[model samples]
Target: MTVTRTLALLLALIAAAAFAPIGPARAQSEGPLRIEITEGVIEPMPFAIAPFIAADSSAEDYTGRITRVIANDLASTGLFREIGRDAHIGRVTSLDAPIQYADWRAINAQALIAGRASVSGGRITLGFRLFDVVSGQQMGQGLEFAGDVDDWRRMAHKIADEVYSRITGEEGYFDTRIVFVAETGPAENRTKRIAIMDQDGANLSYLTDGSALVFAPRFSPTGRRILFTSYDSGFPRIVLLDITTMRRQIIGEQEGTMTFAPRFSPDGDTVVYSLSVGGTTDLYSLDLTNGQRRQLTNAPSIATAPSFSPDGRRIVFESDRSGSSQLYIMPAGGGEAERISFGQGRYGTPVWSPRGDLIAFTKQHEGRFHIGVMRVDGSEERLLTASFLDEGPTWAPNGRVIMFTRQNAGGDPALYSVDISGRNLRRVPTETAASDPAWSPSLP
Candidate 1:
């Protein structure tokens, strides 16, 4: 993809999940209250979260904050409607107390959550349980998370994950990080820096100074190294940065050329990117282990924005070979390609979902921009967001949600997320304007 319009369009399409939201329900009083994610009408399951009991007197603030975090995480999914505290007929006051399931059921709570928190020795130990209020039974085994005091938010997310997983049967994505280009200044002279933060926009830290322009910062599958394009050397080049050490190395060096749009392979040992020469660009892969180079695409038509499937058997990329920009798929080893997108709009920036099912893309048609997803074979295309500019869709680790950048004319861009079902559209609370968000896999 080129930067003027078509290439620029490639950087923007940060959506695309082929998800029909899971529907939760209380089937029978004693039957397992589980949600099947594949096919159902989404009427968020009603759940009540009691303020976590402070096992220690000093744990009061943490108890409240942790419960709120858990509730917020569940609410954000649009899968659970948190019952307000004031609406509850009973309260949880002791960590070992029995839950009044009848009271919760009387208030129409299908699920109930109770937790306990203790602060000691500069560490926080949190334990939580999820119950099927209607059935008056524990849904799953209770979980306990212990960490340093400052890691309270993550602990809460872990609890939420347990509850979500117990109910939905899908893995949770709450304990994840999103790395993106943090923007500042005006639309004309914007300074972009690579920043990392929690999935909810907490714990933000800049990975790069804004002295240079950066784009498409993707996390390695291991989340230890990052691949991105930067203009630090006065020309666009692909660079790799270590997350813990903050050291960077420019890869695939050439005498004089442009190398951009970098992404880690499934193995995280190779990077696939676009190299520009003369008037055309092609895809190339650089193996980090042996410094081996391989040309993946040699199309005279511009080919960029290549993303590898989860199994590394296939690749999805954006190309302009068909007289216009469209999505194309090829073998991960590189070979003849097949055009995938046959829509009215121009498609670019195709990223494969982690689940290896859908490819999310950015499209421009009829003057407006959108972030959308299509099946692996390019069927079931669904646009999740429409805006003046929406691009760069990265999948949550679970692939249940997609986050992309949304920009209005003359305004800085902000990160936004929408469910795969095209519901629960919300802004990621980034501290600054952000774009090209690449969601990190869950932390260890």
Candidate 2:
């Protein structure tokens, strides 16, 4: 099967049903311990991941690698704490071995994970189970995944997605990708190229070279194309890149005007972007099926960075119509925009959340730049990170986390991610500096 097909199977296995409560079976006589995500988390919930049982001697190396991946996925969320490998007291020797709940409880583990892996017929088959040691019961249905032996890392991620979804009562985003601008060189002369990588900073690849200056690379809904601004022709042009063909088409480039900062509509049939003409920048949409253009914003002030709501009914964008950069919402076609941001800052790069409930943005206030989010209607505003320069907020596939560029004074740009709850702030491991990351929807 193709990579996309395999991803479809993974999502089907993990997300076909709505989120159930994260605990033991509801019919249990005794109450089960659970983690409330909204509650103040003083510490991460403790869990243990045992070495996966190798169904064959040929799978022994893979068993340990896959087990560590599951442990890292849970630990990185800042919700589950993995007890050190040295703390292990029990192991699984068979695919159907009984979990030693007493051993897990003795080590203060609230939850335990066990699995078995096998290599056969040029394929790898994996089976995993989750247990609630506190309640001494299985957490959910056991799962099995089969795939090519070379795709062991992807299988590990698929398993991790299942474990995360069952324990967090939320959709899993592990099987996703991020496109960004990879940077190198000094602060004064930084060179950037369009780059792609897995959510965990693995499988890194540069899609473009440093010959052109690129910014704000947004993925299409199908994740097959990318829209970004490139300054290769002495003026910025919005370029559409087909990943499979490695071909580029500059969208709506006229002789006199410069077009930049392009983004796709929810359905991916059209693009909305900024076109600077005669000292005025306005928002415009280009029909990809036909070379048709419609101006969405004809304001005197600069209007740019337009993002569509999930349903395509509305668009949120940044403009300086009110004498300061702020966020506004309007109809997808064209209409009066209602101001959504009225905070003590200059806001830019407003991105509507994939969940459609919140809008993430970059705010500059009190001599500091912060990544912040607010309700779609611009209420309940909360800032997630602060740095000398924090901008271009992009939501994770599940809308639970935001990734953006963070640069300090006289420093180069790099990529960082923060949870929507204002926790788990960490830098994405990149060999070079990175910025303007756009997360792809869950694959397949």
Candidate 3:
């Protein structure tokens, strides 16, 4: 997405998500969203992950390194804690050696993971298993991966997914990838374009020519195509581009209306956006399957920045019908939108967390912008960053970290990340100035 429109939509979204309420009932307290889930209280899992044993002399090169990467990925999630390397008791270089459950229990680790890496010719194969220390039994069947040596990280992520799914009974996020805007250049004339990369910031590839401004690029659920808004015609319109071939097609045939803030439904068969007609903006949804269009909101006030919930049964967007912008959730097919945010600021760019538990947004209050999260019902507002301008938050596939753009007045803009808890803030360095970050779904 173009930097200006991206920031503008975020500005509108922040106004929609954090504005002051107009009525005495407190719009947010109308009632919790119907899709609310009572996620159980989470406790860190103590896991002992050791280097994969090499099955033969040929496999020695990547034995320890590959296993270490797997362990590190799991530990970094914050849900799993790794037992220190120095605390390891009995080493199992081969999966066949029975695990010493007592030793892992001594370290207070509930789960023990052991694996072996083998290379036959040019292909690499990995096998791993998770053990329940308390039960003294294998938690699930062993997992195996086969790929080229260059795909070792993918294999590791798959192994982590298996373990995560087995323990939590929830779908694993490790298999996902993120598609974001890779930016470089000055603040005013930034060389921004669409880019795809792994969730860990690796294997980055440019998807646009950098000749025009692209903003808010979102991946289809299948990751085969990307839906974004571009200003190739000097006015923004919703466009869909095939990520692989870079071919694109604009959705609407309107002559003068400008479209912005586009997103794909969970099914990836529909797109929702705001179209400005004669200076009045409203919400509309287009069926990608048939090119049919339907209006969702017709208020003179703007109803922009639409996002679909995970189940695709509802949508959360920002509207200014109350004189100022605030978050609103409504049925995906179209209905009354219940206001969700009642804070003393403007809320904008409301993006639902992939986990379906929280909504991340941009907030502006008292001359400063902030990136924050709140329940779908607009409860428990937690701001993650505050600065001259912090906007455009995209969640990591895992939902534990958020990436966005931060601009300091006339200074260069850059991409930064912070844990959802507002900790572990760090900047993601690019070859040049980067903004308008759009994280992709997990890689195929």
Candidate 4:
């Protein structure tokens, strides 16, 4: 099957699974169900997690540390409530020992997690299990992992993933990283380069020399290559750089044209970008393997900020062919275009949702910029944020939230995220002023 077809099928399956009618057998099964999220409103599942036990002196010191990591991971998701250590009526010290189910239930914990840690020859081993507090039954067989002692974070994230999957029936995004363009200086003379860090903003490292102007860095689905635009020669050109080797080359380096706003296909083998030949801009796709190029749109008006749907069969982009810049959808190989936005203000930068349910964009009206989202059909449009110059709406891995660049009243830019419900607005701190943020897909 074609890459676009496969993606479309996979997205369709995921959507079916997400929005399918629930059978009576799975509708929160009444009392003592232990752990489950009923409806979209997450009723935080109460979980009792005691400090892991240790098999030796070295393991003893790491027990509390590692378990704390696990607890924090679960708590941060806002779906699992951790019983305070003081309220832990039961203290579990080993995975092999019995768990006091009544004690956990007495503390109002619906679930319990127990683990044991061991360290020898600089390697760490973790064994853990999840249990039903009320029924006093093990939910799943225990899991074991071995790794270097320094990889405790990974171990914690893996445990969180297992717990999340067991309870929520959805994948966890805790094990992901975000690569974005870090910015500083003034907007006209912005100093920007590619930098990556943990999804929560840690371990930041720059990938470029920071001497040229770069914009819109996007990670390949596999995160092996970065596709972005650069003005190193005083004219914008599409560039692809290897994340691991730091080697770079100009892609779609056509003569007398400016190319920008690039993104990788869902399969990570092709790049779709906007190229301006003369004064008219259009969308083009370039095959990474053989340098083949195909024009996807031909219009007199500007057609920039092209994004492929998860299945890659269609492209969502911003174009002014209808007078003002608005969102449009077209076949990936080029065909009749359908307008998806008819809102009052001008819209640009239409990005397909990771889950393929909606398209996010930047809207300008009343001298203010706002980040908004709408169904692919252009219905149910909702604005998530408004500011002096808020633009560049990027979706979280799960499509439950959006992160965008926000310029304060004074034009100081920073990264901020708001839940799709327009709640939980929080500023993501970076080392410097940042904008043009692009979030990566969920990590493996």
Candidate 5:
């Protein structure tokens, strides 16, 4: 059979098996399998993944690797727990085999994922189905993905994204990327380079050599370009780098002035950044199409770290206009601003969430640093982390998690992420000391 027809037949068969009647050991709960992320302690839902059946010898090498990545992706979220394979009473030997729902429910598995893999002519195809074991029904229709063999990991991430979205009702961040500044050597003479990596710290590649000091690498909305502050010419300047061509151009440049902390507008056609001239710093927006600059904030105090709202209607940034560093919101076209942070600490590095409902920022007070978030109007302020130093909070694509740089006393900085609910704080793996993490939007 042709590959397309074969895939369709496989999905039809799985759909048939997924709808079969539940046996005697079915769960008592009639509610759909779901997790509500809240402030209270949550018991992780248990899920199982059967070994992906390999359709051919060429596919054997990838089945285990793909399955492991999928499991890790779900487990890292702190919402799903994996039921070890040793506890599985039934094996998934074929894509068309009927699911033994009784065996899965007997082990308290609320969700079951079964997959099949096939390889032919330098391409690999993956098909999977997610079943809500407790409800004894398929959570969604069976789906399949095909890609080059070298992109197996991305395929696995795509599958995980589907499963995550189906159960959590939120977009998945598994297939996104992160851009950061990679540091090496002593604290005083460290070399910083622009680096990019997969969300799980894989496929690491340096975009720039350690010759110039790079900071605050921000991804464009399309994830095809980057904006960062570079000190290559002995002064900080905003530089735009194209990921596909590796071409760099200095933007927002002015004679005898410095510009930094740049971010792209929602439409990716304009850049908002801080410009410093004559010891006075202000925020400015530049249109990429016609090279027109519009001053957003004209304050005597420092105003920097400008971020645009998702709708491109307003901008949120940090300033000391109130006698200390604090976050403020103003119209995107430049007008009167309003202070949004009234907390005890000094706030800076404000980032507007992709959802446009909240803002994430870094705060410092009484010898401790924190990463926090608050509603757009500065209500319901919540601090998600407190440490010796935590700064530069970046939201995940779904706006459910925030990643920032954490540093202990007399130690190098590392990337750390925490759920918005103030749980599941964990370090992000990287090869060297890293900071200034910028999360890219979900890939197409």
Candidate 6:
């Protein structure tokens, strides 16, 4: 049989094996498995991950690491709780081994994951199957991946993504990357460089040498390029850098003008940013393909931090036209604008969610900073975080979580992530003080 057909047949067999009758003790969880994002307290669902079997001696070294990464990814979301391995009645020794449903049910494991890892000829292979303990069935198809050994972590992330999606009925964000500004030295004279890392803070590497100050690193839709603000010429300028070759060039450069807070259009063919000329900053769009520039906003006030909606037809930006910083939305072609923020605080850094349903922004009010989201029409505002200095909110690819910069009084800045429901606020690990986090879409 062909490889694809063989894999399909194997998955069919696995599914067949999981169709055993459900047990009485596990009957309570017979319905669909899902986690609802809400403001109320949630009891995380309990799941069990059997240590992945090493199908070959060469795979033993990677089995433990892959399992740990998958466990961490699921646990970090706070929606799934992992049962300790010590509590398990038996272990998964092979890919086709029958699951001991009674043992897993005894430990109150609603979901179970079993996987196998094998390595040969400089390539690694991973396979995993998720089971619904209550129904005594496989949640979905058994999946497998083969890639270079160095890409083992990404394969693990893909496995985690599959398990998460099969359970929550939503797209997973674990197989992604984050670009941010890495800062060193004291707060006053800090040196900032553009850096990128995996979502779990592994595989960190710097894109810039810290010779010039860089800020607000935004990933392109393809995750192959980055747009950021650089102060190399003693002025803030928007620059585009290719992640593969590390080649960079200035964008929308004009004599005696400054540009910052650049973000890519949904199609990655254009860039929308704030350009300051003669002390008046306004929003502009640059066509990257043909080197054409169009003014998107013409006002006597400071208009900056422009972000494009997912449809690429409208732009949401922060402006001080009303004498205080607030959010405004306008057509991509530059026309009449509508104010979208009407609250007690001054709002800035408005980013439209990838789902095109809501906008996230930074709000400062009454000596405190907040990261908040609101309906596109500016209603139903909900604040997700409040701290001494929290700003620059960026949404995950799935639009369910927001990561932003948070710094306490007399403390250095760091990256933090919070669910849209304001649960599971956690610090993102970094080698240095990190800020201006931008999440990339899932890797191809």
- CA displacement after TM-score superposition, residue 408 of candidate 4 (Å): 2.3
lDDT of 4 by residue, 282-349 (tens): 99999988889999988998999989899989999999998999999998888899999998989998
Per-candidate alpha-carbon RMSD to the true structure: 8.9, 4.3, 12.3, 6.8, 5.7, 5.5
Better of 1 and 6 by TM-score: 6
Give lDDT: candidate 1, residue 290.
99
Candidate models: Cα lDDT each:
0.84, 0.84, 0.76, 0.77, 0.88, 0.88
Off by over 4 Å in 4: 1-43, 60-65, 186-188
For residues 1-444, what per-residue lDDT tens digits would candidate 5 score against the true structure? Answer: 122333453344333222222222222232488877778889888999999999999999999999999999999899899998899997878756778889899999999999988998888888888888987876666767776788788778878987887788787888889999999999889899999999999899999999998899999998999999999999999999999899999999998999999999999999999999988899999999999999988889899999999999999999998899999999999999999999897999999999999999999999999999999999999999999999999999999989999999999999998999999998999999999999999876
lDDT of candidate model 2 versus the reference = 0.84
What TM-score number comes out for model 5? 0.93
TM-score of each: 0.91, 0.92, 0.80, 0.85, 0.93, 0.93
lDDT of 3 at 371: 98
Candidate 1 residues lying further than 4 Å off, grouped into runs, are: 1-31, 38-40
| Candidate 2 lDDT, 336-411, residue by residue in tens | 9999999998999999999899999999999999999999989999998999999999988788889999998988
The order of the candidates by lDDT, greatest first, is: 5, 6, 2, 1, 4, 3
TM match of model 2 to true structure: 0.92
**Ranking according to TM-score, highest score first:** 6, 5, 2, 1, 4, 3
- Residue 217 CA error for candidate 1 (Å)? 0.7
- Of 3 and 6, which scores higher on TM-score? 6
Candidate 4 residue pairs in backbone clash: 7-311, 8-311
Model 6 over residues 99-167: C-alpha lDDT tens digits?
Answer: 878888999998999998889888887888888887777666676777678888987897888788767
- Whichever of 1 and 3 has more TM-score, that candidate is 1
User: Quick one: best lDDT, which candidate?
Assistant: 5
Candidate 6 TM-score versus the reference? 0.93
RMSD, candidate 2, Å = 4.3
Q: Candidate 4: TM-score?
A: 0.85
